[model samples]
Target chain A: MQRRLFLQGMLGVVAATRLPASTLLPLMLNGCQREPLLPGTLLSACDDARGNHFVASIQPDGSLGFQIPVPLRAHDSCASKQRDRALFFARRPGRQIYVVDLHERLLIQTIDAEPGRHFYGHGVISADGQWLFTTEQIYATGQGMIGVYRMSQPIRRETEFSSHGMDPHQLQWLSDGETLVIANGGILTHPDQNRENLNPDTMQPALTYVRVRDGALLESHQPPHHQMSLHHLDVSAQDQVVVGVQHQGALTDAVALVGSHRRGSDMQWWMADELTQLRMQQYTASVAVDANGGQAVVSCPRGNGIAVWDMQTGQLINMLDIADAAGVRRQPQQSGWVGTNGAGALVRIDSSGTATALQTLRQYPLRWDNHATLI
Target chain B: MKPRFVRKSRYEKKNRYVRKKMQLLLLIVALLSLAACNDDMTPGQRWLATTTEQIRQGYQQLSAQTRAQQQMADAFCQQPDAQGLQTMQAAWRESMASWQHMQWLRMGPIAQDNDDWKLQFWPDKKNILQRKMQDILEGSEPVSADSLVHASVVVQGFSAQELLLFDPQFATVEKFAGRQCDLLRASTTLTARVGQKLADAWQDETWLKRWVAPTATQAGLTPAHVRNGEILDALLAQIERIKNDKLGEPMGLKTRDKKPNGYFAESWRSENSLANLQNNLLAVQQLIRPAQGYGLFQYLKDSQQQALADEMVIKLDNAQQALQQIHPPLTSAVTDAAQQPALQNAHRALGELATFCKQKLAPALGLTLGFNSNDGD
Candidate 1:
C-alpha cells in the first residue's frame, strides 16, 4: 500500500511537470516494476544559446526525449549494444569523454584523456559490446592511436595501437567484427599551434583497415587526390564504406568530396556535376548510408544542402536544401534518413526524395552539432 | 416473478456531483498557474528587448546624419566656397561618427550584402583604396548610382569621401572640376541610400520579435542569452579594435620597426582619428549604461552579477578619462615623442577594458569567442 502511494505521488509530479504521455508512461511502468528503459532512435550533441553543451535524446518522430548537459563541447556519440549506455567523445584537441547510462538518463562517469593525447571525435563499439575503440592523436609525435577500452563497470583503457597514419578521424567495424576501418585524415595539427594544418602541402590521406586484436594493418587504400582529407565515414550492413572528405587544397579546385571503398580494393571517387560541386563549397561534414546499402547521403554544411548518391553507380541521385544542415543518420526501421542543422531544424527525408520538417522537435532553439548517431 | 429494484439516495448523487466540481476547479487553477508562469519574462528576454530598441535608435540616428551629409556635400559642390567646404566637412564628420556607433554590431543584415565592408574598409596595408580610386578617376567610368553600385566598395563609402575632401591633392576646387565632383556627389548619395536601407531593415517588427524569441526553424537560432552574448562580444570587439589595431599599430606597438607610423592611423589625412575613437567610447557607454533608460549594466546587476557590472562601468570610465587626455590629430600625437606618455596611458586603459571583457565578463555571461564564427576545420 505504501509503494502504491509512492507511485501515485510520482505520477502526480510527472503530471504537474506536463511531460509527454510517452515519457510518463515509461516512468509509471518503472515505478510499479523496476525495468530498464528502452533506447531511443536518435542521439546528438547540441549547444544551447548560452553555449552550454548537452547530449539530447530524440524520438523516432524527431521530438526531444530528454537532455543531459555536459561540461564541455561534445563532438560525437556512439551507443553501446552490450549495455544500456552511450559514450560521448569531445572534439579534437579535447581531453574529456562522458559515459552516459541511457536507461537511467544520467551521466555515469567522465574519463580524462591521457597526458599528451586527445580524441578525434569518433568511436565504435565491438559487436559483442565488450570493447570500445576510440580514435586518438599522440600530440607530441602527430601519430594516430586507437585506444581500446574494456566496457566493465568502471570503463578501463585496456590498450592502444598505432592507426598507421596521421590524424585518424572516424572508424567503424567490418562484417567480421574483428577488422576496423579507419579514415586517417592526413592533416596534422598540434594543440599548442592552435588549429593550423601543418602539413597541407604534404598531406596523403588514406583508408586503412586494421586488425583490432593485434593492431596489424590489414589493408590500405588511397584516393586519387592527395589533398582530400578523408574525415567522416559510415558503413553499411553489407560492409560498404562511404567516406566524406574535406578538401585542403585551393578553393578554386573542384574535387570529389565523397568516395566508396572496400577492403583490398581501390576507392572510387564520386563527383556531382560541376554546378552541384560548386554548390557544395568543397566541404562534406557528415555521411550516412541507408540500411539497404544502395543510397548514401553526405551533408554539406557550408553549402547548406545534402547530396544523395547511388552507391552502385556512383551517380548523384538527389540534393535536398537545408540551411546549415550537418548531422545525419539512417533510420533504424525505415529506408529514410533524418538530418539536423545548426539552425535547429530537424527534417526527415523519405525514400521518394520528399523532406518533411519535424515541427515539434524544432520548437527548441538549440543548435545541433556536426554529427548525430542512431542508438 | 416480479423483481424489486433499489434507488440511490439523493445525498449520494449530490456528493458525486460535488467531487466532480472540485476536480474541475483544481484543473482550472493548475492551468491558470501555468499560464502565469509562461507569461513572466526572463531577465535575458527583457535585456534582448531593450537591446533591440537601442539598435533601432542607433540606425535611425545614422540615417538622419547621412542624409544631412548628402545635402551638405551638394551645397559645397554648388558654391565651392571655403565656408561651404568647412560646413560639408563638419557634416561628414558627424555622419562618420554616427556610422561608428553602429559599426561594432557587425552581424545580421549589416554583415550580409557586403554592407559592412562597404561602410568602412580598414587595415588597408596595401592602400588598395587609393589604387582603386585612382583607377576609377583615370578611366571613363561614369559616376552614377548604377555605375557606383558596381564600383569597388572601397571607392563608394566614407573613407573614399574623406580622401577626396581632405587629402591635399584633391581638396581644392580645381580637383572637384568635372568627374571628381560627380564621383563625390554619387558616393555621398550612395552612402545615404545605404544608411536609409539599414534603418528600414532594423525597423522590421517581425524580425525583432523573432530575434527576441527565436525558434528552431529560424535560420540562426538566436536565443535571448545568445543575443546578449553577441552584444557583449561586439562591445568588447569595438574596444579591442580601438586599442589594438586603431591605436596600437600607429603607436608602434604592433610594428617591427618600433617607431610610430602616422600613416597607419584611421582617418589620418583628415586628422579625425582621435575624434572617431572618442565617439566609439561614447557609443560603448551608451550600450553599457544609457541615460534615461536601463542597459546591459542594469541587466547584469539584476542577474546577481553586481561585481562584474561595477567593474565594467569603472573600467569604461577610466578608459574614457584616459582618452580625454590624448589630443586630436592622433597621427601627429603618436609621432610626437613628447605626447608618448598620454598615448600610452590611453592604450593601457583601453587594453584593460578589453581584457576585462574577454577574461571576466565573457565567462560570467557564459559566452565563448570565435566558436561559431570561425571555421571549425
Candidate 2:
C-alpha cells in the first residue's frame, strides 16, 4: 500500500479542500488536547438527540479514552452489556448508526438508518444483545413509535403505539425477564425538530410499559409535572426506575423520580417531581442504576455534580460536587460517562459515587460523549 | 550736411534694436530646453534608486530565509516531537514484553527447524491479516477535537481568516495543510527513531531475533517454554558473531569517513509494501478473532492444520536460502537491501498494533482493572 493509503486507513481522513489559514490554526492547537472519558465505564450509557456517536473507554488502571469521533453527526449512544461495542445513532436530518468496536477503537461497522419521517431520542441495547430499541420522538405518518432492530439481521420492526402523547426521549427495558417495560418519558415534537406546539391543557409527559413478546403497549402513565422534559432514564435490579428531567424554559425543578409499575396503570408515585430547578438552567444528560441498583446517579452538567438518589426511598441522597471535576463518570467500569466543568482535569465518578482525580487531558473543557462503555 | 547725418544715425539705430530683440528670444528658448531636460532626469534618477533598494531588500530576505532554515534544522534535531518518535521506538520494545504473554503469538504445538521457530510467524501473519486488525495494527483514528481540527475550525471565523488568507504561504500552512503537515511531521520523527534502531541492528545481527519476538509470541511458545535455553542462547551467539563480522560495529560516527563501506544513505523511500502488508495482518489479528478465544492450534481444523504445516516448511526453506545467500564481502550490501523494506514495515506495523491493543482492544476485552477511565482522555 502507498503511504497515503496506509495513512488514510490507519488514522482518519477528511476532505482536504483548503481553508483560510485563520480557520486552520485553532484546529492545529485543538489537536493538542486529548479526549475526555464518559461515565459508567462498564454498565453502558445513552443520551438524548441521537448523540450516540459519542463513545468513551477506560482501563482498569484509570487510563481514559473519550469520545470515539464519528464522521457523521451523532445525537446519542448506548453501550451494550454483552459485547465490547457501542451503538451510536445519528440525530434528525439523518439516520446513520455507527458501531464502535471498543476493543479495536476504530469504527467497526455502520448501520444505515432513514429518519425519513421522524426524530429520534436516546436508545438502548438488550442485555442479551438480541434486540435494540429506540424512541422515535416524532413520527410524521404514524403515531409516535418505538423502532425495534434485530441485531442478527438487517430488518427493523417498529412498534406503532401512541406514546400516550408526543416525543419519547429515552427508552429502556424495565425488567430482566419476560416483560419489556420501557420508560417512555413522553413529549411531542414536530416530525423533524423539537418544536412541538403542545396544547398546555391536553399535553402530558408519560412513562409507558410494553410487553416485548407480544409487542403490546400495555400501560401509560403521565408525570405530575407537564413541563418537565423527562428524557433520560435507568432501571434498577429490583425493577425500580430512576429518571432525570431536563426542564423546559420556565420550569423550576429538574427532578429525579423513582417508581415502579403498579398493576396496569403507573401508580405509587412515592417520588413526585421536586421543584429543584434553580433559574431553570441545568441540562441533565444521563441517569444510571448502580451495579446493585441500590443507589442511582444523575449528571447535572450546569451544577457540576452527580446528584445521587436513594432507590428505596424517593429522596435526594447526596450531591457529589464536581465543580472542580472536568470529566465526571459514574460506573467507571461499565458506563464511562464524562462531563466538563470548563476546565482541563477530568473528575472520575465511580459506580459507588466516589469521585477521584483524573489527568489533565487538553485545553478544551469536556462534554458528555453520548454513551460510555459497558465492559 | 545735417540731413545726411540724421538719415545715417536713424538707420544704424533701427538695425541695433532688431539685433537685440533676436538675441533676447534666443536666450529664452535655451532656458526652456534646459528646464525640460531636468524634469526628465528626475524620473530617471528615481527609477534607478528604487530598483537598487528592491535588490538590496531581496538579498536580505534570502539571507533571513537561510538563517531560518538553519534554525529549523537545529530545532528539528532536538524537538520533543522529534525525540518523541525515538521514545516511541523504545516504547515498542517494552510493548513486546506484553506480547510474550499472549498465547497466540507463541510457538505452534508442532515445531521444526529452530526451537524458537515461533519467532518467524510474524512475517507470515503479516501476509494473512488484512483490514480486520486495523485497531490493533493502527493507532486510534484522530479524534475530531484534536488540535489539528480545532486550529482549522478557528480559521473559519472572520478576523484570523482574513489576516491569514492574505499571506499565501502562512495561509496554506495554517488552513490548507496544517493538520496533515503536523501528522507527517510526527511520522517523520517516528521514522527517524526506527531508523536509529535499524542502524544499531545492522551493527548487531541478533536484531532479527528481537524483530521475531512478536512472530514467536504468535506461535504460542516463548524462550522460557523452549526445551533448552542454553542451546537457543548459543544459536543467538552464533547469529551475533555472523552479524558482527559481516556488518562491522558502530564506532560512533567519528570514524565514518575512514570506513570502506557505507550501509546507510540520507533518505530512502520505498513503496511501503511490507509495512502495509504487516499492518493489514496486525489489524485482522487484533480483532476479536474466533481462533484467539481458544488456542490457534486447538481451533485449527483439519485443513488449517495441513496449511500450517506446509507454511512452516516453506519458512524453513526461506531461512535456509537466507543463510546461503550470506557471503563475507557481499553480506552487508545484501542484508541492507533485504532487511530495509521489511524492518521499516515491521516497526511501523508494530507501533500501530501496540497503540490499538492499548487503546481499543484491551478495553473491549474488559481487562481494565480499577484504572480510571477519565484520565486517559
Candidate 3:
C-alpha cells in the first residue's frame, strides 16, 4: 500500500501541468516547494453536513489520504501495527463501533455493544496488534467494563472484564505493552438519563492500571479534587502518563487541569500560572506527548489556547492561541506536534515553541474532533 | 498690438471655459443617475436590508408589548382587583410572544450584553427561577427596577414573570399584594426598558451600514462572499437551536430516557411553550422568505440556486403545518400519552427543516458552521 501511494505521488510530480520544465528549473534552484510530504498518516473522525460521520486519514502534509463513513459520530481511533486496519469508537453513549481498513479505504467490520452497554469514545489496540480493548459502561449499574476483541478477519469479542473504575474514557497501553492505563472519569451517567452527570457532587475520578492478560487491577490513583474528572490521557515512551481533566465543579473554582502520573507514584498536578489557568476554563479537550517523551501539549478548546509542558520538570513551557483547537498528536519522528481545531485549522508547533499554520488543510469544511492519532 | 489677433485669442479662451463648465455638469448628472439606480447593492446587501428591517420590526413589537405589560402591571398594582389581574396576565402573554419573535436574531446587539438570557432564562432544568423568586419574594431585596438590575437573572426575566402571573400560589390579588406586586411591576418595567434599548440599538444607521456593507469593515470580511456565508451560518444556527434545544428537549427527543419531561418545556408555567415555538418558526420563515419582499430565499434565487431555495421553502412550510396541529400547553402535550404522537410528528417536521437548512442551504451558500462550544466534550 505504501509503495503504491509513493508511486502515485511520483506520477503527480512528473505530470505537473501548471509548471512547465522551464519554470520548474528556477523553482527547484530557489529551493522552493522542496520540503517533501511527511511519511505517515493521521486519523480523525469528521462530521459532514449530512449528519454522516467519517473516519478520515490525513497525510503528514495535511492532505487527505482516505475517508470512510461511519454510522455515527466517532471520537478517538487506534491503529493496528500488524494490519492496515484501525478501530474507531463511537462517541459516548453510542453503541456502534467501526473498523476500517486504511489500505483498501473501506470499513471492514461493524461491532455493536451488548445490550445495556455503551462506548465511552475511546479504546486501545494491544501491542502485538492481535486484540483490541474498549472502555464501555453497563448503563444499568454505571460500572465500567472493558470489552476485548480478537483482531481477525471477522473480529470476535473474546472476553470482558471490569475497568476497576466508573466511566473509563481514554486508555493507553503502557510501555511494557502488558499493562493498560485508563482514565476513569468518575461522573455517573446513564443512557436513561441522557448526558447529565448524575453524581457530579460525589464523583470520585481515578487513573487505574490493569494487566491486559487477566484484567487484574495493578494500581489506581486519584487527584485530590473529586470533581476533576480525568477523561483523556497519553503515555510517553518513558512510561509517563499525562492526563487532561474536565472539571464538573463550579465555574468559579480554580483547579489544576493537567496532571502527570507514573505507576506506584502519586499523581502530580501541574497548572499554568494564575492568568493562564483562569483562561483554561477548567476543561482540557485533548493531550499529546512529543515523540521524545520529554514534552506534552494540551489543547483547551474553551480557552482557544494550547499549553506545552516539560514532562520531566513538570513546568509550563509556553502557551499559543488557536481558535477552537482540540485534537493534538505528535508528528512522526519529529520533536514537534500537530494540532487540529473546529475552525478547520491545522497547526504545527516545533520543539522551540514556534507555531506555524499549515495552510493547505485549512480549507477543509469539517470540524476536527477531539483526538487525531499519528499512524 | 493688432486688433484682429487680440479678438481671436479672447474668443478661444471663452470657448475653453464654457467647455469645462459643460463637462462638469455632465459628470454631476451621471453621478446622480448612478445613485438613483442603486446598482452598487448586491444580492447579499438586499438580503441584509430585509433582515435588518425584520429585526427592527420585531424589536419594536417587543418594545410595545413589554410597555403594555408594564402598564397593565401598574394598573393591577393600583386596583388590586380580579379584572385587573386578568388584564395583566393577557398583557404578559402578549409580551412573551413578542419576545419570542426576536429570539432568532441572536447576533449583533442582542447577542452582546447577555440580552437574550436577560430577556428569558430558559431550560430552568433545576427550577432555578422558582428557587430564586421564592427567596427574593420572602427576603427584603428591594423590588424595584434599580434593584432588579443586580438581582439574580433567573428572577428578573420572562420566566419569573410567568410564575407570578400563572403559578397558583401567586396569581391572586391577595397573594400578590405589596412586595409581590412590586416585584411584578419592577420585572415588567425592566423588560420594557431592555426591549426599548434593543430596538433603539438596531435603529443605529452606522450599524445598518456596516451590516449591509460587510466588506468595507476592518473585520477582514474581505469579499461579499464571506459576509454572506456568515449570514447564512447565523440563520441556520437559529434553526438548529429551535429544533434541537427549544423543541427537541421538551418533546423528549433529546432526553436519555426518551420519556417526555414537561418541566423541560419553555414557558410551561404559562402553558405557552408551543406558542413560543410557533412565534420562533414565524420569525425564521419571515427572515428566510418574507411575504412581500426579498429575503434569503430571493438571495439564493439570485445566486442561481433556485431549486435549493424552493425545497427549503417547502420544508419550512411543512414544519409550520406540523406545528399548527399540536395543541397549546406543549408542557402537557409532551407528557400526555395521547398527545405524544402529535408531538413526535412536529419534532420530525422541524428536524427535517433543520436538516435542509444545514445540509442543503449551507453548502450551496458556501457557509460552514463554526465550532460551537457545546458541540463535544
lDDT of each: 0.75, 0.38, 0.75
User: Which number leads on TM-score?
Assistant: 3
Candidate 1 displacement at residue A93 in angstroms: 2.4
* Error of model 1, residue A83, in angstroms: 8.2
The digit string of per-residue lDDT tens for model 3 on B57-147 reads 7887999899989988888898688888888888988998899887766556764455766788766666767778888889876779999
lDDT (Cα, 0-100) at A71 in candidate 1: 82
TM-score for each predicted model, relative to the true structure: 0.63, 0.38, 0.64
Q: Candidate 1: what is its chain A TM-score?
A: 0.88
In the range A54-113, model 1's lDDT, one tens digit per residue, is: 888665434465688998788788888743677888888778888887767788889888
Candidate 1: which docking quality band? incorrect
Off by over 4 Å in 1: A1-73, A81-83, A106-115, A124-135, A144-374, B1-49, B72-92, B107-114, B122-143, B151-156, B159-184, B211-213, B216-278, B300-308, B319-371, B374-377
If candidate 2 were superposed on the true structure by all CA atoms, what would the RMSD be?
A: 33.9
Which segments of model 2 are wrong by more than 4 Å? Answer: A1-56, A59-68, A80-84, A92-94, A153-165, A191-201, A253-283, A323-345, A350-366, B1-377
lDDT of 2 by residue, A101-184 (tens): 554555777775445544353566667877777666444543456667776534354444444445666666666554454544
TM-score (0 to 1) of chain B for each candidate: 0.84, 0.18, 0.85
